[model samples]
Target: MIVQDQANDFPVGPEDTSASQATQDQLHKSYRMPDEQARDPALHIAKDWVQKKKLPDMSNITDPQLRRYATLYPKLRLTSDGTLFLEEGTGDDQRLRLCVPAALIAEVIRCLHQHPLAGHLGRYRTYLQAKRRFYWPNMHKHISCAVEGCTTCRQSKERKATKQVPLGQTSTKEHTRFAKFYCDLVGPWPNARGPGTKKYLLTLQDAVTKYPEAWAITDATAENIIRVLTNEFFPRYGVGMTIVSDQGRQFISTLFQHAVKRLGVFTVKTQAYEPKTNPVERLHRTLENVIRCSMENEKVHPTQWH
Candidate 1:
């Protein structure tokens, strides 16, 4: 016979020995025992001992659940109305946690985990909250499974760590000062100045000596890049044995390629989306910081960046 609590619409009676059709349906949906079983037999036995103010005789208790209760007898408590509780802590910090049966374990966890105030906390936090109010065998394990299986958590929570391949070294032992160069373009600064009101910077760094250079230009076109490399850079530094750059349009343009080829310089482009493959990328950050600090110290407006 099933006894229902009208006020809360919850099942309060122990389950009948024969499973009903509704019970089977609920089992299919949740894979848990029916809600009709509010009291486990093991807990009932423990409650009897608690009410009588005596310890249970565990020697003959062969049932696994009953044996489990026997082991927890020291912390078990019973109320006058037959409700079972597990006592935790001592003295002023004492707490009585309701001993929940297997049938209602899922419901309890669902309410605690999905509560608006609870805000769908992770496994350990949900376990801590459940532990404060309810007691059950392997409570942490149950809560962990519930939290892990939650669709909302799986969909919304970001992974704690992302796997990535280690960065490959770009320099070799045979490299020397000015022999290999890493080059990139930086900005269209909001503040434009100098001849042609230059607003962009073309930066280059030596792989071996770590030497760096930059030139301001009005645009990052292939023509401007070729002019900087052929007329200024190659003449001063001599044609680099090799130059590493990103796959930007200015660097990959036919004009830029032909100019480097004629100078007898081998050009290598870094892999797409892999900035670390070009060492000059790191120099950009330091360059920006130094420029910003110098401008502030000299009270020079960024328009004079050229």
Candidate 2:
């Protein structure tokens, strides 16, 4: 794997045309010629360095071992056209890979990341594209940095959005069943009962068992909602200590507030736009699916959805 040529052990020999052709074929499978000379800034630096037959001095390298390698290694070999490169691998696996200059690292990354034929790819794919024909110190780090900074690549990829802060304890201190209920309004569904008869849906779910209760109401007004809660919900599930609902006008109305307060019930309202905080909102999707599928089948009519 270490394809270096020193005075002893591994010595640099005359170039083999057949072996070189094979390497070229392998490289050709992945490598595409850059569109213009200026596009890959590393190539320009390499060309200039080769033309001058000189490399930047690394005499100030703090590590003695690294200073020695820096002083001796790069000058040991070059490509046929005199471009600076590191000879890697051994025997049949040997390859002459481009030695990228630090100044051109960003440019090289841009070229590889946006390579017309192979650009706009993921981090690993972009890294492999560059790896096929180039070498540099911390090459992977640079490639990863480039991919992370690439707006096109980042925007094109589909990724899930995760909440940074965890929702600690979701429910109230009360541990009793039906102690807390999450309430929300589903929608103004398409005219299910003739025209505008049963347009809105009121969804209620228990915080403990996740058992859901829903009612189809003509409107989302306070009177209509309190009727369902008092007659249908409270009678069936029994009144709980707390009612959690979103900040809808109906939930905050004086009539509904007085109605719950008369029952010795506490009302907790979730912040606007924070749908996840309201557990009943999660059930709306399943409720909608059930309603839609049932309406489609001949056995169930939309008016009978309630």
Candidate 3:
């Protein structure tokens, strides 16, 4: 099939009419190949001239041709660029302006018509309708996808606002305000290397200041705990307003109570089975964590618990 070049390629050589048969009357004006031009990338990428022509009147155009055009230019799918019509913007919407240029629209039409997926245009058309339908609604509303032939963001990217929870438990009001303090014994952790060789930890924490006093023991009897608590720690830190402790037999025993009553130091005990009555228990949890983490690098320190 012979291809017809653009009608306005050059002033169609004024129809030559005077040549005789013997003079070999040229059938058409001689068309010369254009002189080669250098390839300028920028020239190819330049935007097309502004739209000026009236939109085409394809009133008699068959659905088959429209379908074919849609294949070449998806948005304006045309079988060939030459077959394109100048499009007009409707009001200020210029919705079609968001689409590719008439040239590309023409190519989209061309591809669509000839594409093996031509039968699937109805689905695509539904999507195109959606893009136009949802994007910029109610004047300022918006919805669109950034992919080829996508109506709803190409099946859309599912994004969820990340609900990040703060990392650790937050503190509430301070449990006490002055020099009141807390103390407790944490362990007689069974010896890993041998039994009957007991190891235990003692924690003494200030209730008001929240500072800690720590000690380690070979055993956790009431006598041993009170002896060291009164003689050693109190002298240095001064008698606290109060001491809160777990319900160990030592803190409840007569000997331990007598020592506190004589010294005028008040004693508070955590309710049986409730460790939190002693806020120092929280610090104990931290110390336990420290021990656990250090265990990976070194064996649990038995005597250095303080």
In each prediction, how many residue pairs overlap at the backbone (N, C-alpha, C within less than 3 A)? 0, 0, 31
Compared to the true structure, candidate 1 yields what TM-score? 0.43
Q: Give the TM-score comparing model 2 with the true structure, all chains together.
A: 0.42
Lowest lDDT 10-mer window, candidate 3? 18-27
On residues 83-134, what C-alpha lDDT tens digit does candidate 3 reach at each position?
A: 1221224455432212222222333332222232221122344234323311
Whole-model lDDT values for every prediction: 0.70, 0.63, 0.45
> Candidate 2 local accuracy as lDDT?
0.63
Best by TM-score: 1
Task: Indicate whether candidate 1 or candidate 3 has the larger lDDT.
Answer: 1
lDDT of 3: 0.45
Q: Which portions of model 2 miss their true places by more than 4 Å? A: 1-174, 193-196, 299-306
All-Cα superposition RMSD per candidate? 22.0, 19.2, 28.9
Name the best candidate (by lDDT).
1
Assess the local accuracy of residue 21 in candidate 2 as a C-alpha lDDT between 0 and 100. 27
Using lDDT as the measure, name the better of candidate 2 and candidate 3.
2
Q: How does each model score on TM-score?
A: 0.43, 0.42, 0.39
lDDT of 2 by residue, 57-80 (tens): 665445543443355465434443
lDDT tens digits, residue span 1-306, model 1: 012222212122223321222322243365322222335676767776666767656798998877877788888765433456667787766656667777778877876666533556678877877766567788888989998898765654444565898998753685567888899999887667456878889999888889889998889899998888877898888874898999999999998899889989999999999988888987776566446534443567768865
For candidate 3, what's the RMSD? Answer: 28.9
